[model samples]
Target chain A: MTDTTTLSVEELTQIVTRIFSQNGLSALQAEAVAAVIVAGERDACKSHGIYRIEGCLQTVRAGKVAPQAEPELIDDGSALLRVDAKGAFSPAAFAIGAPVLAQRAKDQGIAALAINSCTHFSALWPEVEALTGMGLAALAMCPSYSTVAPAGGTQPLLGTNPLAFGWPRPDHPPYVFDFATSVAARGEIELHRRAGKPIPEGWAIGPDGTPTTDPEDALAGAMLTFGGHKGSAISTMIELLAGAMIGDLTSPEALDYLGTTSLSPHHGELVIAFSPEKFAAGRGGDPFSRAELLFSAILGQGARLPSQRRFSARETSLRSGIRLSAAEMAMLNEFLAAA
Target chain B: MTDTTTLSVEELTQIVTRIFSQNGLSALQAEAVAAVIVAGERDACKSHGIYRIEGCLQTVRAGKVAPQAEPELIDDGSALLRVDAKGAFSPAAFAIGAPVLAQRAKDQGIAALAINSCTHFSALWPEVEALTGMGLAALAMCPSYSTVAPAGGTQPLLGTNPLAFGWPRPDHPPYVFDFATSVAARGEIELHRRAGKPIPEGWAIGPDGTPTTDPEDALAGAMLTFGGHKGSAISTMIELLAGAMIGDLTSPEALDYLGTTSLSPHHGELVIAFSPEKFAAGRGGDPFSRAELLFSAILGQGARLPSQRRFSARETSLRSGIRLSAAEMAMLNEFLAAA
Candidate 1:
C-alpha cells in the first residue's frame, strides 16, 4: 500500500486554483471553484473532488463549458428571478445567483431563483451553507442527465437528481442536508468497482430487472430508487421541478436528440431562501429569538445538525491537513501536468 | 372475506366532506380537505386519508385547531410573505396561502410564503396541483413531529417529513411527486399489520436495535431513514428548514413541556411558485412555449409524468367510482358516528 501524503488546505486549494487558471478559468472563478473542490476532497468526497478535475478540463477543452462565462440575469423581481448561466460552472452560478436570492429574500422575506443552462461539478453543501450563514433557510434541487430508473422500470429515465436544504442554527454550524435521490450514486458504484468489492443487493438491478452484486452489471443496468417507490416518486418530481420547470434537458429522450454537438451535462438548479424573523408572531423584536427558543426546546434531549458529519470531517482536515492516497494524488498530478 | 364496495368519486367525496363539516370544519375547507383525503384513500394511501380524521378532530375539538381561521399575512413584499395560520386547519391554510403565493408569482414572476402554526392533515399533491393548474411550477415541504431516527442512532428524533414538487406539462396533467424521507411510512407498517403480513426486513428496526419483522416493535422502536446516511441527513435538514426555520416545534426537545394542553401538531409549510412566462427568452410570446418544446423532447420516448399514476387513478375513480375496503368504510363510519 502506498503511504498517503498530507497537504495543507491552502496548498491544495492553491494548486487546484493554479491549474484551473492555467487552463481557461478566470482567476476569481478558478479560486472559488477550487476552494469547493478541495473542500470536497478534504471531506473525502473523492468523486466530486479532484477526481472530477479531469472531466471539468475535458468539458472546457471541448468548448462545451465556458470558464469565464458569467451568469446573466434574465428576470429579476422581489420574490423570484431567472438566470441564464451561459454555460458557466455551477459553483460560479451559485456564487452569483445565491446571494441575489438571499438578498431578495432578506428584503422581501422570501425569494427563489431558477438557474438554467449550467454545468454540474460540485457538492451542494457549500452553497447551501452560505445561504444559511446569512440567516436564511434554503432548499435547492438540480436535474441531470439520466442515470437512474423509475420504480419498477428497467430503463434509465431519470437522473440521480439531488435535493438539498439548509437552515441557520442559533449556536452551531448551519444545518445542511444534501443528497441525491438514488439507491447508490454512480460514483459509489465506481469506487466499489475500482476497489473490486461486491455491491450490496437491492442497490441496483441488472438489465433483466434482477438485483445484482456485481458493480459492472449494476452499471450496465440501472440504479434502483432509494426506498423503492417513495424514492422513485421523489426522483420523478425532481425531474419535473428542476428539469421541465427550469427549461433544462431532463429525460433520456430529450438528451439523446440535442443535435450534433455533444450536450455538456446541462443541469438546471432551483434555490429558495426564507427569513424566519418575518414569521415571528407577537414577538416585539428578534424574530429569531423565538426560533432560538423553539429550537432549544425541540432539541431538548440530544440532536445535531445534518451537516455535522461533514463539518467534523472538515475540522479534522483543518487540524491535521487533508490526506490523499497515492492514486488520487497521481490523478491530480496528471491533470495538472496536462494543464 | 367482505367484498370491496365501489362508490362513485362524487359519492365518496360527499361522504367525506359531510363528515368533516359535521365535525366543525367550514364547508369549503371541509370539501378541500375531503378531496385530498378521499383521493389518498382511492390511491390506496390509507395513512394520509380518512384514517387520521379522528386524530384531527381530537385536536380541533380541544380548541387547538380553529375551524375557520384564515391565514393572515404577517409580512408582505413583491416576492415573499410570511403567513400565520393562527392555529387553523392545514387545508384552510393551504387554500388561503397557495393562491396568494400563486397570484403573487404570476404578478411579479415569483412568490413564496412560509406557513406556520397549522395542524397536520392531508396529502400535499392537491395543493401542488392547485398551483400547477394556475400555470405555475410549485414545490412544498412540511416538517412534522419526530417519527424517525438519525442513522446509527436508536432514538426517534425526526418526523417522517414529506416533500412535494410539481410542474405543469404540455397537454398532460401536471407531474407531481410527494414522498416522506422514511424507509416506510408508519401507515404502511400499520397496513402490513392489519393484513397480517410481515414487514420488510431492512425497512425498520425494533426497540432492541435489531431488525424485526414485527410492525408493533418497529413502531415502538424507530423508523429507518430512507437511504441510510443520506436519508438521515435529509431528515435532519428538513427539521431545520421546515421546523426551526419556520419557528415551529421541531425535535422532541424543542416542544413545550408546560401544561397538559394537548400538544398542537404544528407543521411549517413552505411553498414556492414560479411562472415560466417570466423566464422564457421569447419576446411577448407564450411563456410556456419553451417549456413545451423541451417537454415534448423529453417525452419523445416512453417517458411519463410523475403524477400519471394518480391522474389515472383519478380518472378511474371518476369513471367507475372509487373502491373502498369494507374495513376502511367501517372506520370512516366509526369516525362519523363518534363526531
Candidate 2:
C-alpha cells in the first residue's frame, strides 16, 4: 500500500504535465491536459480527474490519439463557426474554440461553434465558467460514444452525454452547472469495481437486459438514463444536437468504427455564447447590478447558485488541502514508479 | 356524463379561440393562444393542452395576465432584441418574438431575444418547429415560480422550468424536443387528483418536507427533480440563465407578492436562432443535403429523433383524430357549455 500525500495545485499540475509529456504528448498539449485533470481533482470530481490519466496515456501511446494535432477552422463569420479537431485532445480544441466564439459574440452579440471529431473533454464547467466570468452567458453540449441506454429499453444507444450552462452573477461565482444525463457515470462504476461492491439496481443493466449489481456485468451492459423517460428524452436530444448537428458519428452504429479505442472515440461539441448586454443595454440600470438584485430576491428563502457546492468543496480543499483515498494514491504512486 | 366527440384541428382551434375571446382576450390574441393549446392537445400533451385553458382564463380574469396587451420591444439591433411582455399572453409574445429572431438570424447568421415578465407559454416545440420549418435552428428556455427543490435540498426553489431546441433536417420534420426538469409536471398532479389516484412515493413531497403520494399534498409540497441532484442542477442553471440572465425574478425571496395569483411572477425567456447557411456557406453542398446525409449516417441503426414520438402522435391524430378521455371530454364540454 502506498502512503497518501497532499500536493498543492502547482505540484499536482507539474506532476501531471510531466506524465503527459513523458507519454508522448507535446509540451503545450500536456500543459492543457494537465490543467484540466488537476482542476477536476481539485474539485473532487475524481472520475474525470487523475483517474483518467492512465487510459488517456494508453490511447496516446497506441497512436490512437494525435497529441500534436491541432484544430482547424472550417468557417468563421459574424456569429457562427465550424471547426475540425483533427484528432487532437478536446481541451486543446476547446481552448482554441471557446475564445473565438466568445469574441464573435462580443462582436456580433451572439455566436455559435461546432467542434467535430475531438477527443474527450475532461469536464465542461471550466470552459463555460471561463466565458461567463468574462461577462458572457454560455451553453455547451457534447455527444460521446454509446455507453448509456435509452430510457426504457436495455440497449446502449447513447453516451453519458453531458450538458452545461453558465450565467454571470454579481459579486459571486458565475452560476455554472455541469452534469451527465445518465443515472451514474462510468467513473462511478469504476469506483464500485474497485471496492468489490454491487451497484444498486436501476443504475445499470447487463448485456442480457437484466439489471445487475456486478460492475463487471455493467461494464458489458449499459448505464441507465438519469431520470427514466425525461432523462432519456434529453439524452436523445443531446445525441442529435451534439452529434448530428456537429456532423460527427452518433449512436451505436456510429460507434462501431469510432469506439475502437478511447483515444479515437468519436465526439462532437456545440458551444453558444451571447452577451446579456445585448438585452440589458440602455435599460437605465446596470445589467449586472439588476441581475444581482433579481437573483438576490429570488434566492430570498436561502437558495444557492448551481456551482456553490463545487465551489464550497474547492474552498475546503484550498483551506485544508485535498484528500485522496488510499487506493487513488497507490495508483498514482504506481504510475509515477513505472515512469 | 359527457358525450365524446372527434373534432378536426380547425374545429378545436375555433372553439378554443371563441372561448378565449369570450373571456376578454382580443380576437388575434385568442387565435394565437388557441393555436398553441390545440396543437398540444392534438399531439397528446394533455398537460399543456386544453387542461390548462381554464386556469389560464382564471389568470386572465384575475387581472394577473393581460388579454390584449402587446409586448413592447425593449431593445432592437441587428442581431439582438429584448421585449417586455407587459403582462401579455406568452403565445402572443412568441408570435411576435420568434419570427423576429428567426428573420434576424437569417440575415445576420444568428440572433437572440429575451422576453421578460410573460405568462406561461404552452408547448414550446410547436414554436421551435415553426422556426425549424423556416430552416433555422432554435433554442429556448423559460423560468417560472419556484416549484422544484435544488439538489440535496427539500425546499422548493425553482419552477418546473422547461427547455426546447430544434434543428432543421432534410425532407423530414424538424427535429424538436421540449422537456421539463421535474420528474412530472404540475399537470400530472392535477390528473392524479382528478382520478383520485396516489402518485408514486418520491415523486413529490408535502409542505412539511415529507414524501407524499396524495396529489393535493404534493401540490402543496414541491415536485422532486427528475434525476435527483442532476436534474435539480440543470433546473437551477435554467433559472439562472433564463431568469437571472434576463433580469427577471428567480427565487421566491425576490417576489413582491408570493403565490399563484401574482401578476408578475418573475418569469423570463431566452430564445436563440441560427442559420446553418451562415457556417456551411460555400461548402459545396446544399444545407438540407448535408443535414440529410449526416442524419442518415447517424441514424443508421433505427435511431430516432427526439420529437419522433410526438410527431407520430400528431400523425396518428391527423389520421384517426384525437381521442379525448371521458373525463377530458367532460371538461371540454363544460367549457363549451359555459361559452
Candidate 3:
C-alpha cells in the first residue's frame, strides 16, 4: 500500500496559494484560484483538486495567461454584466462578478454575467454554488479547445463543453451538477492510453471517421458527445452562448489561439443567475419546499441526486482532514519548493 | 402505395381551428392551439403533427383542460413574467405571454416566463421559435406526467420532460432543437408494442429495475433518460425549474392529478429569453456572424445542424402543400363532421 498524507483544507489552500503567488499570480488571482482547487479537494473531486495546480502554473509559464492582470467589471445597469479578465485566470474574474450578478438577479429577477478573455481551468460547480449560496439558482457554461466531434460528423468541431447548474436548498447543501458534454473527458482517454487499455466503443471516432476503441487512435481523432445527437445539440448551444454570444473564442478558435491543448484553454464563460423567490412570488407553493419534495421523491426512488457524493465527502473532510496519496503530497511539496 | 391528399398550410389550420372551435374551445384558444398543431405538420414532425389533434380533443373532452379559460398575464415589470393559464391549453398561454417575454428580455438582457396551470400538449419548439423570431435566443422546458424512472431508480418518478433551445440566424431558419429527455418517447414504445417489436437496450427497464428490451414490459415499467445520469440530471433540473420552482404540478403530481397519461398533462412551463445583442454588448464581434462561423464549421465537417431536416421539410411543405395519407384525410373529415 502507498503512503498517504492528510491536510486541512485551509492548510492545503495556503500552500497552493503560496505557490501561485510566489510564481507569478497576483494576490487576487492566487487566492481565488486556490479556493476552487481546495474546494475540489475538500469535496474529494480529485480531478479538479491538487492535480490541477501544475496546469495553472504551466499556463502561466507559457505566458498564455496574464498572472497579474486585474479583472474589470463593466455594468451598463442592465441585467447583463461583463467581466473582462484581461487574459488572466478565470477564478478572479468570477469572484469579482458573482456578487454583482447575484444582486442583479435579485433586482431584475434574472441576470447573466459574461466573463471574457480568461484562462478557464476549473469546474463550474464552484461558481454556481457561490450563487446558490446567495439563495439564487445558477447556470454556468463555457467552451474548451476543440476536442469533441459533433454527432454524425467526423472531425472535432465542438469542445467537450461543460454545463453546470445549481439550485439552493434551504435545509441542505445546494443541488448541483457539473458535467462535460462529451461521452468521456480527454483526461480519461489519456489515462487509458497511459494504461495501454483500449477505450470503450462510442467514446471516440478515429481520424478516418470510424468509431475506434484504441485509445491512441481515439486521441488522434475526436471524442464523441454523450447521448448522440441530443448531447451534440446541447454542446453546440454552449459554443454559441458561452463562446460566440459572449464574443470570445469558440472551441476551434480557442485551439487555434493556443496552438495546443497542453496548457489551459483561454476562453470566456457565461453564468446566469435566477432569483427563485421572485419567480415563485405569486405562485402556489414555496419553491424551496417544493424542491425538497422533488428531491425526496428522487431519493425515495433510490436514485441519488447529483453531487451527493461530493457533499458527503465534504462533510467528512470538514470533520476530518482531506486524505491525499503520498505522491500527491510529494508533488505539492515540489511545487512549493520550485516556486 | 397509399393514396394521399394535399392541402395548403392555411387550409389545414382553418380545418383544425374549426374543429376545436366547434367542439368547445373559444376562438382565441382554438386559434392558438391550431397554430401549433399546424406548425408541427408544417415541419413534418409527424409525431407532434395532426396525430396530436386527437389528444388535444380528448383532453378537452375529459374536462381536464379548459376550452375557454382566457390566459391572464401577471407582470410586475420585473424581468420575470407570469401567465396564469387557468387550466387552459398551453398554446394560448404561451401566445399571450411570448411577446411580453421578448420585450422583457430585450429590456433586461435576460427574462423568464413562468406559465402556470396549463395543460401542455404541444412541443416547446414553437414557443422558442417565437422568441427567436424576435432576435433572441430562447430556452423552454416543462414537465409531463410521470412515465420515466430516474437514472438509477426503478419506479417511474419523473416525466418525459422536453427541453428546447433556439438561436436566431439572420438569413436562414433559426437554429432549433426540441427533444424529450427520455431515451425514447413513450409513443415510440407504444408503436413498438403495436408492431410486436422489442425496444433497444438502454431504452427502459422492467418493473424489477432490470434492463429489458420487451416493449410491453418496458411500457409497464419505466423509460430511462437519455445519456444515463447526465440526461437524468437535466430532466431533474427541468422538474425543478419548470415544475416546482414555477409553483405548479411536477411530473408525479401531474400524473396524480390526472390519474392517467391519456390526456395532456396539467403543469407549468418555464421559458427564458436572452438577447444576444444585449449579452454580446461591449464585446468583440457580432454574435450572429460569429455563430455562423461555428455553424459553417459543423456543416463543413459533414455534420448537419439539429433542425436542418425539419427546415428542409418545411420548405418543401410550404412550396407544395402538406401531403397527408388518405386515412389521415378521413380522420380530419371525421373530426370536422363530429364537431
Candidate 4:
C-alpha cells in the first residue's frame, strides 16, 4: 500500500499558512486563505483543497495578485457593503467583509456585499456558510474567466459562473449548495482530457460549433451551460449582477486581460444576506422549525441534501484527522522547500 | 384559417377586468389581475394568459379566495417590505407593495418584498419587469403545490418552483427570464396526456419510482427538475427563502392545505430588488452600458437572449392588436355571457 500521512485540521492549516506566508502573503491573507483551503480538505472537497495551492502560488509568482495588500471595507452605512480587494486574493477580502455583511442583514433585514478587484479562486460555499453560521440566509455568485458558451452559441462568451446559497439550521449543519452553472466544470473536462476519456454528450461543443464528446475538442472549444437555456440565462445574470453591475470585469474582459485561463481570474463577487428572523416576524411559524420539516420530507423521499456528503466527511475528519496520500505529502514538502 | 378576433390591449384588459369584477373580485384585485393576463397574452405566453382565468374563477367559486380582501403593506423602513394579501389574488398585493420596494431598493441599494397569504397564479415575469421598468434589477420566486420530485428521489416533495430575474436596459426592453425549475412544466405533461402523446424521457417518473415517458403515468407520478441536482438545489433554495423563511407554505404544505392543484395555490412570494446605480456608485463603468456590451457579445455569438421571443411578440401586439383564435375567443365569450 502507498504511504499516507494523517494530519489534524489545525496542523494542516498551519502548514498551509506558512507556505503562503513564506511565499509573500501577509499574515491576514495567508491565514484567511489557509482556512478555506483547509476547510475544503476537511470536507473531502479535494478539488478546492490542497490541490489549489499551486494555482494560488502561480498567481502570486506571476505578479497578478497583491500578496501583502490589505482589503479595505467601504461601508457607507447602507444595506450594501463594498470591499476593495486592491488586486489581492478574494479570501482576505471576503474575510474582512462577512461580519459586517451579517450585521447589516440583521439591521436592514436584507443586505448585499460587493467584493471588487480581487483574484477569486475559491468556492463560494465558505462565504455563504459564514453568513449561515451567523444565523442568516445567504446567496453568493461571481463570474470567472470566459470558458463557457451561452446555450445555442459556439463561442465562449460566459463564464462557468458559480451560484451558491445557504440557510441556517439550528443544531444541524446548514442547508448549503454551491455549483458551477456549466454542464460540467472546466476542471472536469480537463480531467477527462488528462485521462484520455471522452466527455459526455452535451457538456461541450467543438470549435466548429457542433456537439463534441472528444475531450481535446471540448477543451479547444467551449463548455455548455447546465440545463440549457435556463442555466445560460442564470449565468448571464451572474455576469450582469456580479461582474458588470459591481463595476468589475465581465468574463470575456477578464479573459482578455489575463490572456490565459491558467491563472486565477480577476473579478468581483456579490453576496446577499437575509435575516430569517426579520423576514418571518409577525408571521405564523418559526422559520427554522419550518425549514426542518422541509428537510425531513426531502430526506424521507430518499433525496439527498446537497452537502450531506461534505458534512458527513467533515464529521469523520474532525474525529479521525485528514488522511493524505504519499504523493500529496511529497507535493506539499516540495512547495514548502521552494517557499 | 379559422375565424379569429383581434382586440386592442386596453379592450382585452377591460374584458378580463369585467369578468373578474363580475365573479366577485374587488376592483383592486380585478384590475391588477387583468393587467398581468393582458400582458401575458400580448407577449404570446398563452400558458399564462387567458387560459388562467378559468382556474381563477374555479378558485373563487370554491370559496378558497377572499375576492374582496384588500392587501395591506407593512413596512418597517428597513430593507424588507411585507404585503399581507389577506387570502386574495397575488397581483393586487404585489401592486400595492412594488413601489415601496422599488423606493427602498433605491435608497438602501437592495431590498426584499415578501407577499404572504396570497393566491398566486400569474407568472413572475410581470413583477420582475415592473422593477426593471423602474431601473432596478429584480429577482422573484415562489412555491407552487408539490408536483416535482427532488433530484435523486422518486416522490413529489418539491414544487415546479418558478424563478424569475430581470435586469434594466437603457434603450431596450429589459433582460428578463422566468422559468419553472422542472425538466418539463406540469402543464406540458397535462397537454401531452390530453393529446394522447408521450412525454420525453427524463421528464418524469411513475408512481413506482421508475423513469417514465407515458404522459398519463407521468402526470400520475412526479416530475423531474431541470439540470438534475443543480436545478433541484435552486428549487430547494426557493422553498427555504420564499416559503419557510417567509413563514409561508412550502410546496408540500401548500399541496396539503389546498388538497388539489386545480385551483391557484395559496402561498407566499419573495422579490428582491437591487439598484445598479447604487451598486456601481464609484465603479469604473456604467452598469447599463456595460451590460449592453455583454448582451451584444452574446448575440454576436449567434445565441439569443432569454426574452427575445416575448419582446418580438409584444412589438407585434402593440403594432397590430393581439390576435386570438376562434376557440380562445369562444372561451372568453362564454365566460362573459355567464358573468
Candidate 5:
C-alpha cells in the first residue's frame, strides 16, 4: 500500500537470513550473520547494513570467506583465549565466542580473547555491548588495510584501527563506545569532498607531507591520526595489540597476505572481555553505583554518552520500520534468484 | 660558578630527599618522593618537577598528607589488588604497590591494582614505565580536580584525566605513552593567559558559552576535550574506572573534600599491570617474535614513538647535569633554611 517498501525488523532479518542461507551458509551461520546485519540496518548504518550484502556475498563467492566454516576455539588457558575464525566473517565468530569470553571473564576476574583469520567490516559496538549485560567490561580492536599515515610520515602506514570499550550499568543502558584513532572517518572526509566542503584542519595531509583542508587531496594522500602524535601512537599500539600481540599479521602484513587471496582486503581482529563483578574489590562492593555517577554527570551537562545515539536510532527504526532503496532491494533479490 | 646550578641526578635526588625529610616526611618516604621529583626534573618537566615543590611542602605543612604514613594492600582474592595510600604522594604509593602489582599480574596472567585515597601530582608515565621492565604491559590512570569540560558542554565538569599505557619491547626501550584527554594542559593555558596570548580554536570555550580563542576567557570557562566527544567519553571512562569503580571520590567530590586543605587539589589513582607472556596464545607460541614485528614496521616508517622525546631529553639532562633556575634553587634551599 505504501510507495516505499517499509519493512519491520523481523522482515529485514528474515530477508537477510534467507539470502545468506540461499548462498550456501548453514542455518546457524546465516542467523549469526543476519543478527549483525540487522543490528546495523536497525541503527541506520548505511555502509555496514544492507548496503554490504552484495559485497559480502561476492567475498564468499570469491572464496575469500567461507559461508559455512566452523570457528574453533583453538586453546584456552590462563586468562587469555585464542580462537581461529577459519576465514569466516567476524560477526559469525563473535556470536560463537561472545558468551564463552564473558563466562571466562566471570570466572577469572579478567579475561582476554584474540580472534584470528577473520574478515571484519562492522561496527564493533554490538560485540562489546553484548558482554555488558552480564556486568562484564569488554575491549576489542582489529587491524585492516593501512589507509592512514603515521604522524610526520610521508606515506600511508596505518589503518583506521578501531577500538571499542564497554562498561555495565545496573539500571539503565551500559556505557559502550567504539572509535578509530584517526582524526575523521574515511567516509566522512569523502562526504565533505563530494559536497565541495572543506575538512577540518589536522584531519588529513597531502602527498607533500603537509596538512590539507581539501578532502580530495587528503583522500588521495593519507588521513591524519586524531589529536596529532597522541592518536598516531595509539594507532600504532592497536596495530601491535591487535596484530603482533595476538599472533596475527600487522596491517602491512595483512595487505600482503590478502593480496594472494581472492578475498577482500580486510583481515584479523582481537577481542577482550573483563568481568566487573569478578574484578570488583575496592568499592565497599558497589562498583555499579559509581558507574551511574558517570551517566548522571554527562547527561546533566547536556552531552550524550558514547553509543547513546545508536540506541535511540535503533529504537526509532524498529518502530517505524527500515526503508531500503530500490536498487539495494533489487540487488539482494538478485542474489536469491541466482542461487 | 653560574647563577643557575647544574646538579647531577644523584645530587638532585639527595637535595630533594633532604628537603622532604626536613619537611617531616620519614626517611624512606623522602627517598621515594625524591626519586619521582628527580625523574621529572631530569626530564625537564617544567610543571611536575621543581614547580611542584611549594605545593608539596604546603600539603605536608598543613598536615593534609601524612609524611610517615604507610600504604597497605587489602587483598581482593582475585587478580585485582587494592592499595590504600593513606594520603601519601602517588610516587610513594607506587614505590610500595608497583612490585606487588607486577607479581600479582605475573601469577594470575592479568592483574589490576587500584590505589585509593592518594594525592597524585606527578606524571603517571614513570608508574607505567616501571611495570614494563618486568615484561608486564601496564596501564595507569587517575582523575584529578576538574578543569576540562565535556564536548558540547558549557562548564568544566571533568578532570584533565590522565591515562597512560606501556608495552614491553625486547630490544629497544619500552613503548610508553601518557596523554591527558583535554585539549591542552591547564598550566599551559594559564601561561598563555598570563602572557596575554590567544588560545587556538577548538581548544576551549569562553564563559559566555561560545567557542573562544582567548586563553583568559577559556580558562574562566572550560578547556575543551581533545578530539572532541571521543576524548570526553574516554575521560568519563577513566573517572569511572579510577574513581567510582574503586570506591573513591570523583573530581568534584575530591574538590569538595579538599575545600579546607592547603593541599593543591589532586587525589586518588588507579594502576593496572598485565603480563604479556601470560596472555600470549598465537604466533606459533613465539609471542616475542610477533611483538618484534610491530617494532620493525613502525621503525621502518620514520615516525617516532610517544616516549622518544622524553627519553632523549632525560638522557641529555642526566649527561649534562640538570640545570635548575636561580628561583628554583632558592626555593629548594628555603626548605632547608626554614627547617
Candidate 6:
C-alpha cells in the first residue's frame, strides 16, 4: 500500500493557494478558493478536498472557468439580493456573496441570495455553516447536469442536486448537513468502483432499469432517487428553485452550456438565510433553548445529529493534521513544481 | 364486497361542509376547511380526505381547535409576514394566508408566511397549489408530535414532517408535491392494518428498533425515516424551520402540549411563496420559458412530473366523480345526520 502523508491545514492551504495563483487566479481569489478546499480537507471529506483539486485545475486550465472575475450584486430591496457570478470560480463568488447574505438576513427578517452563472466547484456546507456561525439559519440548493432519473423512469433527467442546511445549536458547533438529493452522490459510486466493491442494491439501477450491484454500471447508468419518488420530486424542485428561479441553466440546459450531452453536471447555486431572533414569538423561550429540547430528545434516544461526524472530524484534523494519500501528496508536489 | 359509492365534488363538499358547520365551525370556516378535504377527495387522496374528517371533528369537539376563529397577520416588512392561526383549522388559516403571501410575493420578489398556532390536519398541497394558481412557486413545511425514530436510535424523537412545494406550469395544472420525510406515512400503515395486509419491510421498526412488517407494530412503535439517515436529518431541519424557528412547539413540545406521547402528531406549519417574474434573466428568456425547457426534457424521457398523478386524478374524479367505499359513505351519512 502507498504511504499516507500528514499535512497541516496551513501547509496545504499555502501550496493550494500558490497552485491556484499559478493557474490564473489572483492572490486573493486563489486564497479564497484554496481555503474552501482546505477546510474540506480538514474535515476529511476527500471528495471535496484534495481529491477534487485536479478537477479544479483542469477547469481553470481550459479557460472554461474565470479565476478573477468580480461577481455583480443587484440590490433588489432590504431583504432581496441577486448576484451574477460572471463565470467566476464558484467559491470566489460565494466569498463575496455569503457575508452580504448573512448581514441582510440579520438586518431584515429573512433574505434570499440568487446567484447566477456560477460554476460551482466546492461543497455547499461552508457557506451555510458560515451563516450559522453568525446565528442565522441558512439554506443552499444547486442544480447540475442530469445524472439521476426521476423515480419510476429510466432516463436521467435531474441533477444529483444538492441541498445544504445550517442552524445554530447553542453551545456546540452549528448543526449542519449538506447532501445530494440522489440516493447516493456520484463521487461515492466512483469511489466504490475504484475500490472494486459491489454497490448496495437500492443505491442504483443499470441502464436497463434493473437493479445492479456493480458500481461501474451504477455510475454509467444512473443512481436511484433517494426514497423513490419523494427524493425525485425534491430534486425536480431543486432544478426549478436553484436553476430556473435563479435565472441560471437547469440540469438539461447545463449540458448544452457545457457542450456535453451526458458527461459532467455543472451549474449554479442559490442560498437563503433567515434571522432567528427577528421572527420568534418567544412562546417557547429563545430559538436555541427551544432547539435544545429537541436536541436532548434526539440524544436521549442515542441518535446522533447528522452534522456531528463532520464537525468532530474537523476538530480532530485541526488539532492533529489532515491525512492525504501518497498519490495526493505527489500531485501537490507536481503542482508546486509547475507553479 | 361492499358496493362503491360515487359522489360528485359538489355533493361531497356539501356533506363535509355541513358536518363541520354542525360541529361549531362557521359557514365560512366550514367551507374553507371542507374545500381542502374535498380537493383531496377529488384527487382520490383518501388519506387526506374523509379519513381525516374525524380527526378534525374530534379536535374541534375537544375544544383544542377553534373552528371559527379568524387568523391574524403581522406584516413585518415588504417580504416577511407572521401569522397567528388563532388555533384554527390549518386550511382556514391557509385560506387567509395564501392570498396575502401570493400578493406580497407578486409585489416583492419573494415572501414568507410563518403560520403559528395552527392545528394542521390536512394535506399541505392546497396551500401551495393556491400559490401556483396565481403563477407563483411555493413551499410549506409542518411538524408533528414525534413518531419517527432518528436513524441510529431506537426511540422515536422526530415528527414525520411533511413538506409541500408547488410550481406554476403555464396552461396545464400546476406541478405540486407533498411528502413526509418518513419512509411511509402512519396513515398508510393504519390502512394496511385495517385491510389485514402486511406492511412493507424497511417501512418501520418495532419499538425495539428491529425491522418489522406488522403494520400494527410499525404504527405503535415508530416509523422509519425515508432513505435512512438523510431523511432523518431532513426531519430535524423541519423541526427547526417549522418548529423552533417559527416559535412554535417542536415535536417533543407538541407531545407535551397534547399531553400524550406517541399518539397522533399535531403542530404548526410554515409557508413561503416566490414570484417567478421577479428574478429571471433574459439569458434563455423568462423563467417560465426556461422552465419549459425542463418540462419538455422530463416529458421527452417518457417520465412524468411529480404532480401529474394527482392532477390527472383530480381531473378524472371531476369528470367521473370520486369513489368511496360503503363504509366511508356510511360514515359521511352518520356525520351528516349528526350535523
Q: Highest lDDT among the candidates is held by which one? A: 4
Models ranked on DockQ? 4, 3, 6, 5, 2, 1
Of all true interface contacts, what fraction is found in model 6? Answer: 0.57
Candidate 4 regions with alpha-carbon error over 4 angstroms: none
Superior by lDDT: candidate 3 or candidate 5:
3
lDDT of 1 by residue, B1-339 (tens): 467888877788888888888888877668767877887866656566667667677777777677777667664445665667776767777776777787788776667767777776666777788898998878777766665777766666667777777777668777677778888877788888888888988777788767789988887777888877777776666665566556665655333321222343666677777776664434333535544654453355345545577778777777787777898789778877877
Question: Which residue runs of candidate 5 sit more than 4 Å off their true CA positions?
Answer: A26-28, A74-77, A192-200, A213-216, A260-267, A278-282, B260-266, B285-301
Minimum summed lDDT over a 10-residue window in model 1 chain A is located at A253-262
- lDDT, residue B322, candidate 2: 70
lDDT of model 2, residue A260: 54
lDDT of 4 by residue, A273-295 (tens): 99999999999789999999999
lDDT of candidate 3 over B268-300, digit per residue (tens): 999999999988877768999999999998999
Q: RMSD, each candidate, Å?
A: 4.3, 4.0, 1.2, 1.0, 2.7, 2.4
In model 1, the runs with Cα more than 4 Å from the true position are A1-7, A251-264, A279-306, A323-339, B1-23, B38-53, B68-71, B194-197, B251-264, B281-309, B320-339
**What range of 10 consecutive residues in model 5 chain B has the weakest lDDT sum?**
B259-268
lDDT of each: 0.72, 0.74, 0.94, 0.95, 0.78, 0.82
TM-score of each: 0.85, 0.87, 0.98, 0.99, 0.93, 0.94
Best-performing candidate as measured by DockQ: 4
* Cα-based lDDT at residue A97, candidate 4: 97
Query: Candidates 2 and 5: which is better by lDDT?
Result: 5
DockQ for every model, please. 0.35, 0.37, 0.83, 0.90, 0.55, 0.61
For candidate 3, the iRMS in Å is 0.9
Question: What value does DockQ give for candidate 6?
Answer: 0.61
DockQ score, prediction 4 = 0.90
Better DockQ candidate (3, 6): 3
lDDT of 5 at A249: 71
lDDT tens digits by residue: candidate 4, B1-339: 558889999999999999999989999999999999999999999988999999999999999999999999999999999999999999999999999999999999999999999999999999999999999999999999889999999899899999999999988999999999998899899999999998999999999889999998898899999999999999999999999989899999999999998899999999999999999999878999999999999999999999899999999999999999999889988998898
